[model samples]
Structure formats: structure tokens, C-alpha cells
Target: MSDRTRNTPEMSQSAASRRVAKVGLDSLDNLWFQVGGTLCNLACEHCFISCSPQNDKFKMMSLAQIQPYLDEAVVLGVKEFYFTGGEPFLNDEIFDILEATLAIGPATVLTNGTIITNRRARELARLEANSIYSLEIRVSLDGFDEPSNDRLRGKGSFKLALNGITRLVEQGMLPILTAVQTWSEAEHERMLAGFKQLLADIGYTRPRFKIIPALDLGAYQQNKIGPAVTEYVTEEMLEDFDRSQLICSNSRMVTNSGVHVCPILIDYPDSRMGESLKATTGEYRLRHPACYTCYLSGAICSNFSSGGQSER
Candidate 1:
């Protein structure tokens, strides 16, 4: 975890049915594009959205569809852009979209690190080199070793992902390796140390990594691994809390369907805020179980660790 996110406060939950907190949009600091949609190459057991090769609940977004949102976001003073999906690299035009985004502002892509071929790495390096703004690539790996990671991500995923990470490093790109916490809190330090050693063994010294808590949705729910959280954010809880800690207060997601409240709740019907970014700049209610996760882990969607140990 980064120092900026250490020892942050969590939202207080009450059993009383008090008024739900309505978090208002503070500013459009970050804009996320569901470029790959819900289609992904690998289906991890703990995927919050349950994305798979066959899952098309949310379809991919084309450059044409994304340009308008980028333009609108620039006008709204969005500081950065993010691209994610089932697997962003699976999209045919993902590189083009990244290039376009880098032209305007810093961009980040959340990937599984399985599709980064040598040619792709070269192209990405070129794009990053040419852009005035930074281009960050966040690679998802559930565990440090094959026995542990492949158990969740899939067979042979560990080797393939490591190859991709090495290729990216060879291209002079510092990818942020991310993992969802699958072990107990007592194992965190050992896990972190093991991951660092694993990276070093692969010649990636001083690796940047993030540990995220798994959400009790999608695959986790289907597998009956954990019960859904029943807590809700109430008005009294936000009386003196930093409202900016909520992703809803500063971020919006653009998908093929429309603009949604945040990245985590795109599958929820009520999360669909509006048809456009400008129209969606209003208050959002914390009504879903995932809202409790976000409240406990402050803004677990941004690149920088605001108040949560999770998030890239």
C-alpha cells in the first residue's frame, strides 16, 4: 500500500433505516472507458463483474464511441483517463484508443497481462514515448506463483502474464502489478514479500504493485464464497466525513450502454446515471451492497491510493 492511503477511516454503518447518503459529484477528475466491455480472455474466480469470453452483458466500445466522451471529459476538466474491460488488449482498436487518450491526457489501462506480444509492447512503448502525458498499464495477477495464481486466474496464466510483464519492462514501461487479496490479513506481509521476490527473480526490480480486496459480487456470489454485505451508507455517516473519498463524487464510467455512476456498479440498473457525461453530473445514491465496499475502502477505483489499499 502507498503511504498516501495508510490508516484511512472507514464509513460507519448503522442498523437503523436512516436516509441513504446522496453523494454529489465534486469534479470529473477521472474518466473511465469500458473499452473492452464485459468480454475478457480469462475469467478469474474472484472477478467482481464475472467477465468471460462469452460474457457480453456490456459490449466493447469503439474509438468513435469513446471520442465524444473524451472530448466532453476534457471540457469538464478531467485530469486522467482509464480503460478497462473483460480484457482491454482483446479489443482490436485498444492501442488506437490509448494513443488517442494519451494525446489529450494521462491514461491507464487495466489488463490481465496475457495479450502483450512483442509487437504490441513496441507499439505501446512508442505511444507512451510520443505522448506528453503519461500512459500507465495495470496488470492483474491474483497471486505470486502459478499454483496460487492459476488456481484463480486459470491454468498457465501465471507464465503468460509474467512473459507479458517482462516484455513490457523490456519496452521501458513500468507496469503496476495488481492482485486481489485472497488470503487472510495475517498473510498479507508474506504475500507482499513473495510477490516482490517473484518480480525480482524475473528481472523486474523495484516493482510497483497494489493489493485490492475482493468484492463479494459476480463470481464470488455465484461460487457462494461469501455472503453479500447488508450495510448501507446513511446521511448521518457523511456528516463530517470527506465526501471526496467516494468515487461517485469525482468519477464516471462510459460504456457502450451509457454513462454510469462508477466503474464498480455498471451492471446495476440504478447505476446508469444518464446518456451523457454532462447529464450525469448529479447526486448518486449509495443504494447497492457494493456501495458498502466502496465506503469501507475509500475511492477504490482511482490510480492513486486515496484512502483505500485496494484500487490501482
Candidate 2:
């Protein structure tokens, strides 16, 4: 039997619950722009997309190509826009693209943080100063210190990311430092406290932080899949599951190829929605194990705003 069919009824239940948990795609008002696409500077050990400099599975979306969507999004009641990629800053036109995006609605960029140079910091400051909408940057850091961090991100990456955050603070922008949760309970608290201390020492006294669960995909496949006998989604959980909390239901990600259901399943062949955002709308099958992660986590990717639930 194939991996999908070999699972127990519990696994099928999990998958069904995921499908039911998805919000209506038509109700979606948030637009995610994949500016950097499938090209990232660093080849991290656990990147879900396996993004690297040469992985042009998806290409960059130019300012012109994305601008029309920004305008279209405003009409669709898209209150927020999200930018992500291999590394958004890798594109020379990233500032122009971000500036354009900020004009329509609040924008958030998920970045590795190692690429934020002094020039980019100045641009970020300018974007915040002139725009009526807000701009937030989420910097991904695996650990508070070098040894723990470099283990996942690579040598010298820890220091470089810290430098990027330090620059954001210096530019008068408060950035959210995101870490993946991979430590024991005691170690986890210690890690949080360490981050707090590090931020204070670095002059970002009120630094925001988000810790994420590592999804079993890409490089993580080598580590292991979900538990040996993990449960899938089922219809029963839909009784109380908040479909709006699930990103795939309402939010569609625009990639180089076209649109996809969500960011997590970009590399999945069947996850492709269509050739355009207008063509991609409706239900998505929660067939993959990763779907179960979203179902159980309840908004792991898009749940947070600066201080409140994401403006849906």
C-alpha cells in the first residue's frame, strides 16, 4: 500500500478535519506575495521549501507583475499583505516592491535577517516614516547564541542575523525575532530568557518574538516524518475547529508559477491552484501530512499580528 493509504482511520480523520477547518477561499482578504520565490541565499538544514540560490523552481516576481495584484487586493478587501521568499532582499527591486505594497495596506516580510544591510535599513526606515500603513519585519533566528543557532543555520549565520536585528533596532524599527521550537522545556525557557537578555544588551529592549513548530518536510524528512502512528484529520473535529484560523482556506500564495493554496505546500505538485489568483479559488484537499500540522496547530503560519490576531 502507498504511504497515504497505509495510515489508520485516525490519520484519515485528521485529514478530514483539516479540509473542514479551511475557511472559504472567497472570503479571503489577505494577499501573500512571494517576492523572493524559491531562491534563497542560505540552504538551511530544515527549510520546508528547500530554497537555495539555484532552486529556481519559482522565479522572482517583478514590481510591475506584483503591482496590479496590490491594486486588485485593495478592491478585494485585503487588509494585509505578506512578503516572503528565499530572501526578499536578494532581489534588487525589493525596496520598490515593498514601497508599492506598503501604499495599499500593512505589509509584513518574513526574512532570514542576514541580508539586511545598512542601505536596506535606511530604506526600511523610510518606508515606515512615509507610509500610512505599517511595515513589520520577522527575523528568523533558530537560537539565541552562536553554537545553538549555527547548528541549524550554519556557521557565522548567527552573528550575521544578530547584526541585521541590531540594525533594525538602530533604524527605529521593532522587529519580531522568530525561533523554531526544538528544545526541551527547561532549555526552552532558558533560551527565551537568553533572547530577552540578548535583545536588552543589543538595545532592543522590547523585542517581539515568535517560536514555531518545525514541520516535517524538505530537509526535515531526513530527521524523521511525523510520529510513526500520527493521526490525520477527521470531520468530527470540525464541530469546534475555527476554519478562519486556517490559512489555506482563505489565503492563497502567489508564486512564480502562479497561485498555490498556502506557503507550506508550495513545493507539492498538486498544491498548485492555477495560473492566476482569479482562477484559484475554492477547496483544497488536506491529503498531505503537513496539512495535519496546520490542522492541529490552528494557524501556525498566519495567526499572529504585531500584538493581536491577524486582521482577517
Candidate 3:
């Protein structure tokens, strides 16, 4: 899932059937900004958020709308910040927003890597160069070649993404390439080899790869994808589980709508805690099937985590 899917029948179905597990905020270490909302250039089959060009359930957030959150994050002792969307680069004021964010702390923007022109890469490089904090650009390249990537993304997406990666590489920005896992664990070695070769084709030797898990949302929910979510997190599931590995245990995402529990659950109105960061310090119930992915995969949304990035 990407910046990610929303509203499904899991909650309503489980409401009366059973009690879902809940997680409390250990500490507000990470802050997420839904800068672009659900307005992505490409309508990827795997996006849980179901973000697309026409989907404007939530609108793009301006720097003015985010400044207060940035201020509040500092008060909340937020160690770092993350920027995600349908496609974060789709926003016009993205650079300005990053500039403002970098002034406070490190920031990472999750993008599909299709619209990252040479100019845009240079601007991002400048932002990273100017800041003492780290600026990570995570690009989602679903497959190694055009056929595979384009199948999940769109036609010609592989070429455009390669160009985007090339530009960023030329500017000395090594973006973390994220590919949702669509293959079996047995194919892991083969997939890694192919991905390496793909990066090599574009002169990105020693590329960092983060093979993310495909959550059962959006495309998966509609039977367009495999491994439907049949279970949810229960009290027994969290008995001895390390809650720190969960995003909701230490993160909150701010969208144009309001402050949500986490970036993954923003589509549900119940996920919206309140209008401010203070109101979000409470515990979050793990009702959605997406939580099962986090429970199984660890905090995939975070940069430094036990789960998420496979290597480098």
C-alpha cells in the first residue's frame, strides 16, 4: 500500500463480532504530512489510499496549513517528519513546503518517481545540501522493467521512473527505491538480482532497496489482487508483541481533513482523532485489516525500522 488506501468493510463487519486490539502512543517520534492528499498522477492497482487524479476526497495541503503542525510537532518532540500523498511531487508548493519542514527537522517524501524532472531533482538536491537534517526521497518502482512496472503502475511508467531516478542520481541524490512485494518469498533472490540489474541499466550502482509488502486494501479488496485479508488484530495478537514496531505507537499523520492516527488509516473518519496534535496523544484502536500488515511487517512506513527496507 502507498500513502495509502482507505475505507473498507472490515471495521463495520468486526464491530459487533469482536473487539479489535488497540495501541497507545509510546512517544510522538515521527510526524507525517499528507501534502498531496489523494491526488496521484497514476492510479496504481496496489495503492490502498485509492489515490488518483480524480480522487479529491482530501485536498492538497499548503505550507500555511502545515506550519502550525510543524510548530506543534516540535512541541510534541517529534524527532523527524515524513511527506506522503497520492504523489507528493504533484503539489506545486512541494519544494517550499520541504524548505519550511527542513528548517525544523529532517523530512522524507514518498513519490512515484514519474514526474521528477531534472529541475526538480536539482531543487531537491539543493534542499538536502542546505539542510543539516537528512532528506530522503523514496521512489516507488513496482518492477524492474517496463512490462512489470507498467503492469502495476501504468504504460511507460518504467521509462519515466528510470529517467527520474537517473536525474536524482545525477544530482547526487540516492533515492531509496521501494517496490511492493508481488512475488513469493522463494522469488526474493531472483527479484533482488533483477532489480539490481535494472538499477545498473540506469547507472544506479549500489542502489538502496526497500521491498514493501502488498497490503490487502484497494486493489486487493476488489479481488484485483491476491491474499485477501481474512483476519484482524486481536487482544491475543498484541499479548507479547513489540508495540514500538507499530506506526501508531509513535506517529500521527496530518491531512487537509485533520490529524489522523497514522498515514495508513486516514481514509476512515474514525481515524481522525481531532483538529490538533494534543487531542491525538491518546490510544488508537487497531480495527482495520491494514493493521494486520503492520503487525506482520513491522513499521513499514518508517525509515529506521525492523521491517520496511529489506537492505541498504
Candidate 4:
């Protein structure tokens, strides 16, 4: 769960289909790269982007393609960098890209932890050691056990992911384990306890967990993970709201196609804001269905967030 997608806003029948609100880019603090594009080793059922081995809709980004953006980001005073895709490790140039990014700012990579071999884990440690900034690895998992997790992420995925986490922990890299919120509110503590115990078993005594709000998009909604989005952020909604809480107010994602408003809406054509980061720093209409999710959950796609669903 990016702890993403659906935040069922209670609205009247007339307000059910309201006009989209406008959110401007106040600053460029964070920039994301679809570095792996849509090429992931595992096709998780709840993935908003629907990435997989066969899904090559967006190609892996090369170092040459990403350099210009990094240069522009430096000029913009961007403080952080994020990398995601079907899986960032799928790209051959991922380490190179990471090396270049860390030299400029702190970097975070979202991954499935399926392909983190001992060598790769060691490489990640080396990258962190070589940089002045920090390197964060966020590994995604569905459920705690084989049956619960494998049901959504593929067969034998639990073992593979567990091994990946273990390898990272052994290398002294405390990778954050991320999960989409699929259980009930009452089950939250129970589920977290289960995950804590699971991590402890893998020598991760100080485990960090990121509970993602499930986004009702792509394969997630297709698999009936959550209800279809039926609400939009209206101008009225922002009357007394904190505009800075929204991701579109300060973040932009870079895919091979172009710069997008946000990562959650990458599959939508209208999400593409502009060709470059500088050009894209303008007002964006919160028109996509996914915007409602972000409205309920404050900026669901940031490493600093620990599942922000309690506020506007």
C-alpha cells in the first residue's frame, strides 16, 4: 500500500462530480525519476503503475537522459531525489544513476526487494558510504507470510523478499519495509505487530515500516483492492486547507516520456505537465481521480511520510 489511492470523501450527489481544484508548484524540493520505468520483476497486484517484466510502456532511463534533469534540479535547489519504476534494480545503470544523484542530494529508491543479491546489497552500502548524503532503500511487501504475501505479489516472493531484506540488514543497511494498508483500522496494530516479528526474525531488530494507503488505480482497482475514485478536490475544498500538504504543490516526477505532475498519476496522459522540470513548475489542476486519494492522505509518496491519512 503506498498507503495510497482511495480516500472516499463524503459529498452530496451534486458535489460528487465537482470541478478540479488548482494546485501550483510552490517550490521544487523533491524530484522523482521513473528510472526503472514500468519494468519490474514482479507484477504486484496493488501497483498503481501496473509495472512488470512484459509491461514496457515506459522504458528504463539511462544516465545520459537523467543528467540534464539532475543539472536542472541542482539549479532549482532541489533537496532530495527519488527513484522508482517497475523496480529500480531492473535498470543496469541504476547504480551509476544513484552514484550521480547522491553526489548532489539525498536519494531514495522504492523497490520490491526481489533481486537484492548479496553483491547488490554490498553495492548499496558502498554507495551510501561514498556519498555525503544518505541513501534510502524502501522495499515493498504485501503481507507477512508466504500465503498472504504471495497471493498478491507472486509465488515464492516471500522467501525472495525476506532474503533481500536479510542481505541488506547484514550489510548494515536498514531498508524500510513498505506495505499497502489492506487490513481494517482495528487490525492496524495487529498487522504491524506481525510485521515487526517478521523483521525481528530476519535480524532487523530496529525495523522501520511504511504503511502506504492503497491507491485505487491500475492493477489495484482492476483487482478490486479498493473502490473506484469518485471524488475530486474542488475549489471549496482548499478554502481552509494547507496547500503545502499536497505533493503536487512541490514535487514533479520524470519519466522517459516527460515530466509528470506526480508519480501516482503517471498512467494518465493528462498527468504529463511539461518537457522539463523548469517548464513544469506551474499551476496544476487536480483533475485526476488519484488527486482525491492525495487529498485524504497528505502526500502519500514521500519517504518522510509514515502514512498520513488522519488529516486533510
Candidate 5:
């Protein structure tokens, strides 16, 4: 493990036991499937999970493994489903999984967008069209142009992702373009406008967008030169705050390894609640440093943009 990851607040059992705030599971509203595991086709410099071609710390889940959870989620009255991974599209049964998920509830997939071909986009459109529930595809793009995005994602990634978005647009799908907040807050408006214009140029006029705050994990943690999270959440801090804003209050991530508290903390051992969703219930302590990020940024992993509302 990286020193930064090792130094996370979750690692200090004694300190965490004393200072952490407990968050109970309000309901099982959102179900996330870690379908692709830690295996992406392209390894982005700032990836939270350090997903790559060979990282197998978590293995890809098969359709057979996921079906049982889908059935259970239905019984639990799950309102929405989310698919994420090294890259969810990398999974061979991604379409099948999405099809099954959309049949039950609204579904969203978090993808890097490089693997979305014209054929694949058309198929995705068909799935969305057939489903009664909403189907949202969130594409990750670091920048509006080639140089800026390629710098973080890798060479030739910008062009490929742009092409994929274009195809999705052509297939009548409105995808949510997600970018990490790599620049200062002062530059947010300028960067957002640039992205809007870029998407408009490619026929994605009035594109939906979401900005994500960078987390200190994966490759970012390995480098350990960025701003470090210094604050830990306390019970006193939740006095006047809306606890509903926390993803853990409404969601749980199902992975091949086990059912995790949330999608962001799957790498942390303590985040693994149990082997099954039914087995994982009750409250979870905000012990990881990443919890501070979530505390500061309400449900950062959700489909909606934070827009300063995350900070209480």
C-alpha cells in the first residue's frame, strides 16, 4: 500500500475509535455494482482505484455472480443502480448487467468512454429505449481539448473518448460528461464553458456535466504531493448537518470481494461490511480520510453535480 493510503485516518484504529462519527444506513436506495473491478484499458494518472490492464486486486464480477444481488435489490426496493469499475465497459457482460438492472430500476454506468464504439453506442441506445426506467451514462473526460485531457488520461485518449461521446449523441443518448476538478475553484466557470463549447461543437448541445473533487487514493496517493486531508469527521460535526447527504446513508457497493460501505472506500479493509447485502446493515463509522472528502462534498459519487451544496 502507498504511504498516503497507509497514513489514512482509517488506519489509526485507536484515534478513529475515539473521534469517528457513526452513520446509519437509512435505506437501500442506490445499489452500485463494481463490475469491472480494478482493470481498466487505460490507466489515468489520478484514478482513485489505480485501475489498469493488470491490477487484479479485485476481479471482474460475472453475470451469474451479479444476478443474485439484482434479485435481492428488488426485494430491498432499490430505486437506482450504478455500475463502475476500472472501466465498466471492459466487462464482457456489462450490457447484460445494465439490461437486468434497468429492468428493475433506473441505471447509470460510470465509464471512461474510450471503449464506446458506434456499434456499442447503438446497442446502449436500444437498451435505454427498451427500459421503462432512466438510463444514464456518465463519461469521464479530464479536459475539453486533447492536450489537457491526454496529459492525465494518456496519449490519444481524448480523441477516442470524444469520438465515443459523439457516437452516443448520434445514437440519441444524452450522456453526462464528468470531469475532475483539477484546476482552482476560480477557474471552474471558465473550464465548464470550455467543455460546453467543445461538446456543442460535436453535436452534444446543452450537454449535462458533473465536476468531481479529486480523492487522495490510487496513483494520487502513491505520488503523495497534493493537498492532504487533515480533518477527521466527529459526532459533534453532524449536529446541524443533513446526514442524508452521505451516500452511505442510502447506498452500498457490491463487489466480487464483498459488499462495501460505499463505492469510494472499497480499497479500505474496514469498508467491506460483509459477504452479502443482507448481511451488511446498520451504521458505519466515518473512519477513512476519504470520509472527510464525502463529509465536505455531499454524495460526490452521485449522478448530480456538487455545485457548492456539498459543504455544510
Candidate 6:
């Protein structure tokens, strides 16, 4: 057998099944809205989709572009919605867009946290009170301190992001702090503890934390050890593959390009479902390298209500 065949353990299975048992897209209670699409202000070293100011493979979904889907998603029993982008705040119609979304169900906005303004905080507060549904704001901070985080994110991002979090706390909205797992197991506790202390120092006594594993895609190609070999989903592998843990089993993301398996694989072609949400629900072959990370991380993207930290 060639080295390619040996390396691509699941390639044969993927190629064979490419014409059979195609993954069917299903709409679940949770629907992901690509409100910001592919635009983000701060380009991180390991962003799976390679979100940057210039990377507009998928453009921002405007309020008009998103409302019909929101209406459809609600009808299909979508209880929660997630909003992400290059930087969600960069969208000119963000508040208006969020107000429309908040009216339906719970909404979670994933942001880098530097651009959140005082006015935006007040708007979020208003939305929280006005809407029967809940609103969660997740701030992505790669590390606890500036020195560690700045290098991965960019210069002056750590302090500005902290300011955003502090403002959210003052607004009485407890935003979740999200970090990628880069530290050793022994170091994680210390980092989270320090984060808790730091949040407390900022007067946010109760702070929620999540550590996400890096998905080896986009800019992460530089970090790839080697191309991942996907094993065939045999009866033996089925024993270990927990169906409930995979994001695609429960949710699908709708971007300008179309529906995809999940938010993490928007940029990957194999993950694309179809032009509409209806075409995207079914079993995926689990071919991408990021699938391995998801298998290990399990439900790392969901929001947490309680103020506590969990390993990704």
C-alpha cells in the first residue's frame, strides 16, 4: 500500500461512502446563526476558519439576511442561537440584529471582547430585560496575562479585552471567559485560579471559564504534526464514538455560503452540507483533523450558566 493510503486510514471509507450513505442534515433544538460570518478583527494564530479582516470567504449576515432563517429556526424548535464573526461588534447593525434574535430565543455572542462599548453594554442590558429569552456574551481570551495572550492574539488586546469584560460585569451581565487549552494539566488549575482572582479583582465575583482545544485547521496548518488519519467507523470504533458529543449531531451553522456540519468546519469544503439547512443533516464520515479534537473536547462550544471552570 502507498504511504498515502497508510496515512489516510479513513480515506478509503470516505471515498467509498462519498457516493453512498451521504450525511443528512437535521435541524435540532439549537441552531447556529452565522451573524458575523467570517469577519473578525483580531486574527489569532490558531483560528480554525482563519478569520481575519481580509478573509471574507463568507460575508457578514445582516439583519435582513438573517431574520427569515431566525423565523424558520424558531418554527423548527431551535431553542438557542449562537452568533460569531471576525468581531461581532464590527457589524454596524449588531444591536439591531441581536435585538431581533433575542426576541425569539436565547442568544450567545462569541466575541474577542475588545470592541464591546459602554453603549453596547446598555443595549445588551436592555435586551436581557426585554426578551423572555436569555443572552450570553462569551469573551475569547487566549491566556490569563498580557504577556502570554498578546503574542497569540495581537498587541494591546489583553487589556482592552479585560476592559470589555469588566464593562459587561458592571452591566450586570456575567460574560463567559473562553481560552484555548495550551498549558499543561498542572498549569491549568493555576491559570484558572488566577483568572478567577483577576475577575474578582475587577469586581466580577462569579466568572465562568471554558478551555477549548485547538482545531488544527486554517492558520493551524503550521501547527499540524501531520495529516490526521481517520479510522473507518467500524463496529469497534462505534463503541467509543459517543454520538451525543459531536456538535453536528445536534446543530448546524447557516452562513452566506450555506449550511455546514458545524461552526468549526465552515471553511472546510467536505463539511459543507448544501445551500439550505434542509440539505445538511445526517451522519458525517468524520474525515477532518479537527474532528479528532472534537472527539476529545466534547461539547466544548456550548454556553455555561454557572460560574465555574471546566477542562476542554
- Please give, for residues 114-195, the per-residue lDDT of candidate 4 as tens digits: 9999999999999999999989999988898999899899998899999999999999998999999888899999899999
Residue 262 alpha-carbon offset, candidate 4, angstroms:
0.4
lDDT: the better of candidates 1 and 2? 1
Q: Write the per-residue lDDT of candidate 5 for residues 29-107, one digit (tens) a residue.
A: 8899899998989988888888889888888999899999999988887878899998998898999988888888889
In candidate 3, what are the lDDT values of residues 51-91, reduced to their tens digit? 88899988999999999999988988888899999899999
**How does candidate 5 score on lDDT?**
0.85
Stretches of candidate 5 off by over 4 Å are 1-5, 9-16, 305-312
- Please give, for residues 88-185, the per-residue lDDT of candidate 2 as tens digits: 98888888898888877788889999989988998998998899988989999988889988888888899999999999999999999988776766
Off by over 4 Å in 4: 1-18, 305-312
Residue 74, model 5: lDDT of 86
C-alpha TM-score for every candidate: 0.91, 0.88, 0.92, 0.92, 0.94, 0.87
Candidate 3: where is the Cα deviation over 4 Å? 1-19, 305-312
| Residue 89 C-alpha lDDT in model 6 | 89
lDDT of 1 by residue, 242-275 (tens): 7777889989999999999999878777789999
RMSD of each: 6.2, 3.8, 3.7, 4.0, 2.6, 4.9
Better of 1 and 5 by TM-score: 5
Model 1 gets an lDDT of 0.84
Model 3, poorest ten-residue lDDT window? 303-312
Better of 5 and 6 by lDDT: 5
Q: Relative to the unseen true structure, what is the C-alpha lDDT of residue 190 in candidate 3, on a scale of 0 to 100?
A: 92
Badly placed stretches (over 4 Å) of model 6 are: 1-9, 12-27, 223-235, 305-312
The RMSD (Cα, Å) of candidate 5 is 2.6
TM for candidate 3 is: 0.92
Model 6 over residues 11-81: C-alpha lDDT tens digits? 55655445322223344656776777677888777676777778788888888888877887766777688
The whole-model lDDT of each prediction reads 0.84, 0.77, 0.85, 0.86, 0.85, 0.74
